[model samples]
Target: MELQFLGSGDAFGSGGRFNTCFYVRDARGAFLIDCGASSMIAIRKFGIDPNTIRAVLITHLHGDHFGGLPFFILDAQLVSRRTAPLIIAGPPGLRDRLTTAMETFFPGSTRVERRFVSEIRELEPRCTHDVEGIAVTPFVVKHPCGAPPFALRLTVDGKTLCYSGDTEWVDGLRDAATGADLFIAETYFFDKQVRFHLDYATLARHLPELGVKRVVLTHMNPGMLARVAETGCEAAEDGMVLTV
Candidate 1:
């Protein structure tokens, strides 16, 4: 399996981090873990063909994690002019969220027609579902956003990849990522304890317990990026790719 960090920046895009988005692909095809704001541009910057993406898995409804859906859809429809169907899977209320987002951004963007069909699938927390050819399971994460946050465990080609999509210190983290090939965890703070996000020290203490073969710290702020030189784990950067 191949994992590509399309955009690894936090909300502010500190240190030139684009946002929280990743491209995971195998011999079959490619899918996205999160489609945050500016993710489309980041994908294009990587010289990737957006039309080749078959599915996108969203962790929550936050703009940083899912705000780019309308644009991604529109871009594929108008710009790429793709003919393959696109499937989007996310937490509950995904359809409503996208509808509201479209209405808020130009009033009729979601209603636009395209060369390919766009299907939105809403996932229940902690429940496993199949999207296109990818198997996705979401677990709850502690975040201020009323919408329940999630961490995804993706199984593709018999390989598992876990993504800690914007979460606090949740108990299920270790289990969600346990025994996986790669764990893309988010460490926003270096040592300072904060709500709805993990600090570096806390993550360091928990990393060994997860039992994943590789750990990639992502969704980091400027401070976290600065501390990467000292941290032992790999600090995610835009356009970094890791194969397992």
Candidate 2:
């Protein structure tokens, strides 16, 4: 399995990084972890063929997390002329949120016939669902984004990958990351106790207990980005790729 960081920046685009988006492709298929608002541009900038993506797994409804679906769909329809179905799996109300976002961004977009199919799959907390060929399980987390936020745990082939979407300290995270091959955590701060987000300092302290083989810290602000190197954890940068 292979994992690539297409975009690894916070909502504010600190350090000029793109919004959060990760591309994971194995022999089974290719999918995305989070399609942030700027995901389309990021994908294009990285010279990726967006039509190759089969599905997108979202952790929450926050704009920075799943807001780019509208543009991604449009690209697949108008630009790439995709014929395969695209799966969009996320928390409850994902269908509504996606429709609202689509209409809000490009008025009347939801009513258009894109010549392709987009499947919306709403995921319940702790339930493992098969998306395409990937197994996705969502864990309830602390962030409140007008709906339940989740920390996603994905398994493909025999490799497990976990991501602490955007949340503060939540015990469920430890469970999601347990036995994972790679755990991509959102550490927005370095040491400060910020609400609804994790910090590198606190997350580092718990790393030993998570029992994960590798950890990549992501979704950082300017302060966290500056101090990331000193933390000694592998930090995510736009366009970085890893083999799992």
Q: Which candidate is the best by TM-score?
A: 2
The TM-score, computed over Cα atoms with residue i paired to residue i, of candidate 1 is: 0.96
- Structural similarity to truth (TM-score) of each candidate: 0.96, 0.98
In model 2, where do residues sit more than 4 Å from their true spots?
none
Model 1 CA lDDT for position 132: 82
The ten-residue window of minimal lDDT in model 1 covers 105-114
Whole-model alpha-carbon lDDT for candidate 2? 0.92
Per-residue lDDT over 1-244 for candidate 2, one digit per residue giving the tens place of the 0 to 100 score:
8989988999999999989999988886789999999999999998888878999999999988998899999889889899888999999999999999988889998888877788999998888999999989999999989888999999997999999999998899988998899999999999999789999888988898989999999999999988988998899999999999
Reference-based lDDT, each prediction: 0.85, 0.92
- Cα deviation of 147, candidate 1, in Å: 1.3
Summed over model 1, clashes come to: 0
Candidate 2 matches the true fold with a TM-score of 0.98
> What value does the lDDT take at residue 64 in candidate 1?
86
